[model samples]
Target: MSDKKHKTLCAYVEEELQVKDAKSFISLIQPATHFCEGCGRSVAKPEDVCKPKKLK
Candidate 1:
């Protein structure tokens, strides 16, 4: 691995997707198959969080 961490949902919200991009952000979180073990937030992809765990 490159040892590079994926961009987190929190960072993506604070850095990339802002209030004006709520709709876009929503799309990014839909159909969540996993959740962040560190943050406890559901996300579509494991890469979307700092620490990911399967939804099941």
Candidate 2:
């Protein structure tokens, strides 16, 4: 989706991320530094998620 707003873990496009950017997703998830309070998705950087809450 070209018109997608934010490029966060929670905003991922299934086909786009799975097929094209799966590696990116995997890397973003492991060793995650922050997790989204809104969607429970984790990412390396706070900016990579919607509601980023620091990992304990």
Candidate 3:
């Protein structure tokens, strides 16, 4: 079993935001930074990111 836990993009953002309000959070995430595993950099859209599969 792997010791590392997998988190969605949203989950990772939420952790960075801490206890911010909904409105502020929404505003902050309006332009979310999605990392492209293939390119190894940030992207404009989540679709550009190479998402990992969920372990069943």
- How would you order the candidates by lDDT, starting with the best? 1, 2, 3
Q: For each candidate, what is the lDDT? A: 0.77, 0.77, 0.45
Q: Which residue pairs in candidate 1 have backbone atoms (N, alpha carbon, C) closer than 3 angstroms, thus clashing?
A: none
lDDT of 2 by residue, 15-54 (tens): 4685687776687688888989998887888987878999
For model 1, residues 5-53, the per-residue Cα lDDT tens digits are: 6667878767657476777678668999889888788889888788889
Better of 2 and 3 by lDDT: 2
The window of 10 residues in a row where model 2 has the poorest summed lDDT is 1-10
Clashes of each: 0, 0, 0
Q: What's the TM-score of each model vs. the native? A: 0.74, 0.70, 0.26
Kindly report which residue stretches of model 2 are placed more than 4 angstroms away from their true locations once superposed: 1-6, 13-16
1 or 2, greater by lDDT: 1
Off by over 4 Å in 1: 1-6, 16-18
- Give the Å shift of residue 6 in candidate 1: 5.4
Report the alpha-carbon TM-score of model 1 versus the true structure: 0.74
lDDT of 3 at 42: 44
Q: How far is candidate 3 from the true structure (C-alpha RMSD, Å)?
A: 11.1
